[model samples]
Target chain A: MTGGYGLLVADLIGVAVFAASGASAGVAKRFDLFGVAFVGFAAALGGGIARDLVIGAVPPLAFADWRYAVTAVLASVAVFWLHPKLHRVRRTVLVLDAAGLGLFTATGTLKALDAGVPPVGACLLGMLTAIGGGLTRDLLTGEIPIVLQRDIYAVVALGGAILVTIGHRLGLTGLGPLVTAAVLMTGLRLLALYRRWSAPVAVP
Target chain B: MTGGYGLLVADLIGVAVFAASGASAGVAKRFDLFGVAFVGFAAALGGGIARDLVIGAVPPLAFADWRYAVTAVLASVAVFWLHPKLHRVRRTVLVLDAAGLGLFTATGTLKALDAGVPPVGACLLGMLTAIGGGLTRDLLTGEIPIVLQRDIYAVVALGGAILVTIGHRLGLTGLGPLVTAAVLMTGLRLLALYRRWSAPVAVP
Candidate 1:
């Protein structure tokens, strides 16, 4: 189980990264400030909300927790003001995106398991939690989902979620297991991004 | 206060219309079959799922009832195979879309009221239930949501939902009230479409 403070901190960081990513897309699209914030909020919180709703966690944690919403808003504002500087740091963006994916995958899987979801379902939910936010951002911007179009993104999320689910099932539910799972996921994502690894497409 | 069989029939028709709408968009975008089916399913069912989750209903009714899914799939396949002929019947699509908005608004409001949501919240959720599916479909297809950009669409939904909520509060939760609310909403939508009425936009 993740310590409460540790999980909160990780979640906030993930929200910031996801929000910043969404804000960048909004800026690129020349959306107004309200549109930018809307996309940013959706990207930061949509995944967690989707997972919670599926698991019958009403009002989703993000809705209940002011801090998560504030973090996303802060990220959105920062991106709006400093996007030029943020855009220059390509590597940082990549790393943060990867880290967010890992963190959400771990957290989502654990939450589902705690809610009595079976392992397979928990793993799928975990993957959804990791990818759903970015999917929302891309969709709001009227783009084909990056996860579906290319790269080894969803596979990395699935791999991380599977590991976390298995570890929890094996009585390895400590912070150590969570950290290990997240790190593995993040590393794989970064490697895939760097190597230009892509998922196989159907022969259409 | 809805009769179960009557509500079910209305829901099935709404689902068919929403799915057909989503599939036409997918066909226009030249998405693959999976993409077409995905949008169709989301457009048919996403709104009800959103409403149910907000009211703490687990496993939204659409998920529990296989018929809704089947209706969406049938509509998607129909659009896939017969889009050319279907597209020729533009007026039919418009009428179905209006009918769907009206039906979902009434049903959503009634359901929320039954769940004990406050009148205003119930009204909002009802509107969400009417528009969330198309919002999702538009976002998935990479378009600014029609509800957001166009003529008085969501406003009409909100009006219908409000009427239902107020009627229920006034102890007028009968078939007559429901039908009246729905007809008014549908008529407004159709009038707006025909009259070229548009929502106010910011002067940029």
Candidate 2:
């Protein structure tokens, strides 16, 4: 299942978009080039690395596959230079980020299940894979994680993870369920964003 | 080496001290009980889990062994309830934390070396194991990581790790070098703390 070309492409897209967002955040913070690249890499691959580690996929794909690192670094460098022009299309970046979040959730869940994690654990791992990168990125910049402080971001990923887990339980295979889950999550995230949907904060 | 009763005890002590520090931070931030516990666990075990994952130690000792989790959580709870009392002994806590930092660096390097990691990578893994928890703890509370922002904390860990790696290369075996490295690191950390020594920040 993981060997599929389509899934690989989707994963790379997710890495690139997430890297761009991370790089943009670094730029906003006025980090040096090295710091920006580090943040970009962390935001792009941190989640996948965490998921793989939890599932005992040692050395992690991020270390073994140069493509993931190259793609993330390239996207980050592009954002470093073109952020002024990119800012004009903030909506596009947001939409792409939503798509990346969804893709990560679907693929992460599938990978966890493939590695024999139980259904509940797989769902959690899936959510972690989706949100972990952004969390790291925010934390590095000394901002409260968006997933913890606001928005329906992680919830949407959780929803997609649940869907993938259910599909796996029902003997559903191949990319069909995974793609569906990703699409559904992306749509939900966009809806939530446009609607200003957010989880309630704890009362003071 | 891992099976040594001495190493096991040292590891638990490290976990407890780190957990206490994390819980204290959470309490200072006015986080609720659950958040305190979560922070404690992250601070105590996050590094070990990360090290285990990188080296392919599946399930991580923190998960596989109930004692590690129990020790961390108990320390966190204790800190939550007795922080006022603990405050009277802040110096003691600082000393213990230094010990923990040293122990983790030594054990982490040894484990990485045992796992066949090269000396340079082992040194890095050792430093990560020592500092990863505090970094996570600070990040969770929306603070820039101290390792990146100040002091000689991570550098001391790296020093201990390099010492252990050198010992390994010199055909020194058993607990002698590990203990020496841990002791040296702890002393260095304490001296640095009292002397207000810190690494210089990059100039703007």
Candidate 3:
């Protein structure tokens, strides 16, 4: 395990970015402070909690770490104090949000593989972990889950996880495949946004 | 079992009334038609589902009975189509909602005893089944769960469940205990409403 300052920084960034993103979603839904905090909590920790559950880690993530709560509070604060200013920069938020998504996807994939899940399930779990929070937030707030919509959403996570899995199998765990996974997903996502690469809507 | 037209009417009334309450909540929250329907579904069957899960009933109430979903959807239609008119008499809606609560609570207690849950668990499950929907709805919307706050709340549910449990043990399945449970819970709830009863807020 990469137990060092680098892992800490990566985790911290993921926490902060997801928190901010979640808070913004709650506010957009016109939820009160408690709602905002819940969304923030879901966004920052939802992925990891889900990953833990799937890996048979008992009692989930929040119970294991108090820091998750502290970060959730910070997210609520950002929503209450700086949302108007933050919302103005769509590009910056998207990148930070995508970065967090990338990190979580990688971490989840690594954990699942380490736990002896097959390649398919591990990749699936990785994608689910990366997006579960937003899905839950939308559903709880009475909106359709966005991941099920036409975006390069699950595909991006799957691609990244596959890349990492291949790299790990080949013992190429240096920064190469790690950066490759993150970069490919974030770039594909950003490009999908700019180019409006959406799937054709199905007529009900 | 009260196998007759009267009990059937009571059951149907319970379903429709709870659905109306949920649809009204949806309108208050400004949810879309689908959102309102989902909330109605929750109100109609959330408690039963929670009870089933606790007792290890796989797939739970909605899966076992398609009528539950139909009732929720039909009720949502009424709320959506006639919301402007229905919103006029807030008192009527409240009365109907309370009646639904009493009926569901009574039925839940009976079901728990039938399932062979001990008195303590049976009573707890009854209260859980009675208010589980509203509690879940409030939690998702970031509001304090109603059961955790005002009115008779969990008290009446616990009381009614206790009566039923005791009666079942004494082999007294007459109309007396069932009717008494319903009246006691309903009366206490309305009285609390009139008296403006609330839990005391703790000063930080």
- Winner by DockQ: 2
The candidate scoring highest on TM-score is 2
Model 3 fnat value: 0.00
- Would you list the clashing residue pairs of candidate 2? none
Superposition TM-score, candidate 3 onto the true structure: 0.55
User: C-alpha displacement of A132 in model 2, angstroms?
Assistant: 2.2
C-alpha local distance difference test of each model: 0.85, 0.86, 0.71
Could you tell me every candidate's TM-score relative to the true structure? 0.62, 0.62, 0.55
| Tens-digit lDDT track of model 3 for A39-59 | 677677777777776776533
lDDT (10s digit) by residue, model 1, range B60-143? 666455688779978987787788787579898899899999989998999899999999999999999999999988888878
In candidate 1, position A19 carries an lDDT of: 96
lDDT of 2 at B28: 75
Q: What TM-score would chain B receive for each of the candidates shown?
A: 0.96, 0.97, 0.89
Off by over 4 Å in 2: A1-3, B1-41, B44-48, B61-135, B143-204
Better of 2 and 3 by lDDT: 2
Alpha-carbon runs more than 4 Å astray in model 3: A174-176, A200-204, B1-204
